[model samples]
Target: MEQLATFGAGCFWGVEALFAEQQGVTSTTVGYMGGHTPRVTYNDICQGDTGHAEVVQICFNDSVITYSQLLQLFWQNHNPTTPNQQGPDFGTQYRSVVFYHDQSQQQQAVEMRQTLNNMGLFKAPVITIIEAANQYHLAEDYHQQYLLKRGKASCSL
Candidate 1:
């Protein structure tokens, strides 16, 4: 079955690159979500006034790759302890977030976060927001698969 999972783990470019390499991910789109404004552009997100976080909406085959697995990948790829930042990127747009597509996903994300917190993997508490998936405004064409287009494996630039 096909399922949707959206995550904000700092730069959408890196997030998109990470998940796109996964086995069951059919497609990945970089976008803005959880914002008050509508039809927000990349520039609007850069300004950090739109209340939007750069997110990557992934379409995957659940039968092949479970949502739980994806959640694990999310945790490993970015620093969830930071409130409004990831790596060198600092802003509301770079905050960690998990936009659950349904009740099942919400439960899984919450559980995983709790488990990770108990495990003491990080010095700080995990601050990854778990919320219902909402309005997703697709980023400009140039932003999609940015790293892939540039033949880069990660977001170094």
Candidate 2:
């Protein structure tokens, strides 16, 4: 079966690219989530007042890759210790978050976070938020598959 997993780990560009190349990932859409505003734009998120995090919504085949594996990728790709920031981008839009689609997903996310924390994987504590998915507004077409369009393998970050 196909499942959904939404993650905000730094910029969506590289994040989306990473997952899109994965074995199980069927599709990926870059978007905004966990925000109050309706139909938020890239400019609005950049303004830093929309309460939205730039996110990538991934669709994957559960038989090929488990949600736990996706969580591991999310944790490994970016520093979850820093709040409201990633790499050179400093803002709420770049915050690390996991938007769970079901109770099972929620539980898995929480447990995985705790396990990583207990393992002391990071010098600072992991601060990635695990919450119910909010409205996901797709980013502008120009932002979708941006790295691919530019013939780049990853974001400069």
Candidate 3:
């Protein structure tokens, strides 16, 4: 069956590229989520006042790749200890967050984050937040597949 997973872990460009290359991911859309603003935009998000995070909504086949595996991918890709920042990007929109689509996704995200913390993988505690999926505002057309179109695998930052 097909499932949906939404994540905000730094720049959505790299995040979308990473998932788009995954075996089971069917599609990835860069967007804004977890915000109070309605009809948000890239410009609005860039201002860092929208309370939204730059996110990628992923569609994948569960039979090919489990949600847990996707969560692992998310954890390995970005630093969760830093709040409101990822590499060169710094703002509320760059915060690490997992927007769960349902209870199953919520449980898995919480457990994986806990497991990572217990393992003491990072010097600082993981601060990635897990929240229910909120209204998603699609980014401008140019933002979608930004890296892939440029023949890049991931962000240089």
Residues 1-157 of candidate 1 have per-residue lDDT tens digits of: 9999999999999899999999999999999999999779988889989989999999999989999999999999899999998888999999999999899999999999999999999999998999999899999999999999999999774
- Model 3: lDDT equals 0.94
**Model 2 off-target regions past 4 Å?**
none
Reference-based TM-score of each model: 0.98, 0.98, 0.98
Candidate 2 clashing pairs? none
**C-alpha lDDT values of all predictions:** 0.94, 0.94, 0.94
Residue 33 in candidate 3 has what lDDT?
95
Model 1 TM-score, all chains together = 0.98
Tell me how candidate 1 scores on lDDT. Answer: 0.94
> What's the lDDT for residue 93 in model 3?
98
Clashes of each: 0, 0, 0
What TM-score does structure 3 among the candidates reach? 0.98
| Model 2: per-residue Cα lDDT at residue 5 | 97
